[model samples]
Target: MDGEIRTRFKTICVYCGSNSGNRAVFSDAALDLGRELVKRRIDLVYGGGSVGLMGLISQTVHAGGCDVLGIIPSALMPIEQISGETIGEVKKVSDMHERKAEMARRSDAFIALPGGYGTMEELLEMITWSQLGIHDKPVGLLNVDGYYNPLLALFDKGVEEGFIKTSAREIVISAAKANELLEKMELYTPRHDQVASRTSWELSQLGYSKPPI
Candidate 1:
């Protein structure tokens, strides 16, 4: 196992949609997560923007007196529609690679709200990094309305097919509610952590280089 639970997160990275999805609860989860982060006094690190679920959480947490750091890629500014409404310090990076790197570097842990490809990309990258030992921070899903159930099923499929080990699959934490998820994250300890010490090049043939992403 990794170790004892971390007492303080300091900052948490969140990946979410630039567009609020079809459901009100998706937005509700975003707001709820924002409030939960504030309640815990954890700063927010996320894809930078002032719209959709991203905006909701950033504005909510910032309003609640928590620092928010928004890291964005230059290529996505026009796509995410950056505006004067941004709630916190915004750092511009060259591309998606830089943006993801910065978010992972700044966050103590990660949370994913309902989103699209970009959101999934960020989430999966974090999970991959954890599996590769680039980072061992907790990675979680808000599973709003069981939105992520299909992904979970796919992961199970990976395990059953002998592509993903049972122990490696345990790194991800999922919950229906914000508080529950956060608690799970704080209590999480990494197993199979030693695999991270091996380079991806050495592990790729072992079918350990990446997740389903």
Candidate 2:
């Protein structure tokens, strides 16, 4: 068990915004994250795009001679500037659902960088999946420049409000920097059963009749 826990993950799925914000720090952090992933010899699994922070990260990883795998929807391919040829592999899908599924399938862990609604949606789905025992992968948030602080507080509020399980909160590891976040993830183990139990309890609190499985 110890050996398995300590085993290095081969792939990580990164969710970041397609638009680089006004702050240059966001881009810098993205680059640092990319370089660190390469330093740690981890493969990058991401949305296939060549713009904004996503492109910056992919370019950095490729320049560092690390493996990068992209999954993109066919419709948004041209818009995202899909650089299918430069990366290790690119899998084009029919829609957003397929893209997310493919990305999850290819990754051992999930990380969210500064992003918009799309990125948040992807991260949330992965977290829900982990809670439901669909997957036992670690999910991390790179809170660069306190970008995710508000969201973190909101998550805590959910727990307080009885909407989100406290144990589910433990499943997400948060860090202000890339290296630290990755280091913690290196030691992550999914607490799916705990989360699922908590979710069940939360459901019961809502007075919803539990269906016999």
Candidate 3:
């Protein structure tokens, strides 16, 4: 217990590609992140798919004696659930909206691995949710091998152009490795002014309760 890492998150949702990228580094990062989560005794909530990075990470976490929950949209079930390769408890939602809401409701924080459009979409939505005060959970990027440098630069450009506020930009935490990213996320505190009160949002469907004042 001398060098154990403590985390505030019980379940963290991960957004990643259903298909592993061309490079081996992407797959490696996914596995590394899974190990880190297991080491910290944190459960995982991710897009349901037992292929590519999704499969790698889910299997790693499940094998490490941690809970793994995969939430997938009904429409994509056929594509994502190939060859009966599903891992852990799988939840099917009516649509993408429902899937995302369920994932958010179940997770305490979020992380995005190197992925395509779907991954970017999920990551941005979480950040937007934080900006809108739907939740104050930390959203992090496992920026493995500079995979997210361009995206980060784009974010900085948004700030320079007054499209994004300074405090809101801080909502996204990034690092090149899982351990460092998680450490930073553990220290994250929301400093941005929410567009609306968290309780004001009609998040009942997502099972989010209003915080006690």
Maximum-lDDT candidate: 3
Model 1: colliding residue pairs: none
Where does candidate 3 have its weakest 10-residue lDDT segment? 204-213
lDDT of 1: 0.85
Ranking by lDDT: 3, 1, 2
**lDDT per residue as tens, model 2, 1-213:** 111223377888999989998999999999999988877777798997888999899888888776888888889878887445555577888899778777877788899999999999999998887787556778999999999899999999999999887777888899999989988988886553543442344333223254212
Instruction: Give Cα-based local distance difference scores for all models.
Output: 0.85, 0.81, 0.92
Error of 3 at 58 (Å): 0.2
Q: Over the stretch 167-198, how does candidate 3's per-residue lDDT look in tens digits?
A: 99999999999999999999999999999987
**Candidate 3 Cα deviation (angstroms), residue 210:** 2.7
Error of 3 at 198 (Å): 0.8
- Tell me which residue pairs clash in candidate 2: none
**In terms of TM-score, how similar is model 1 to the real structure?**
0.88
Candidate 1 per-residue C-alpha lDDT over 57-76 given as tens digits, one digit per residue, 9 for 90 to 100: 99999998889999878887
Indicate the residue-level lDDT of 31 in model 2.
96
For all predictions, the C-alpha RMSD in Å is: 6.5, 7.2, 1.7
lDDT of 3 at 5: 64
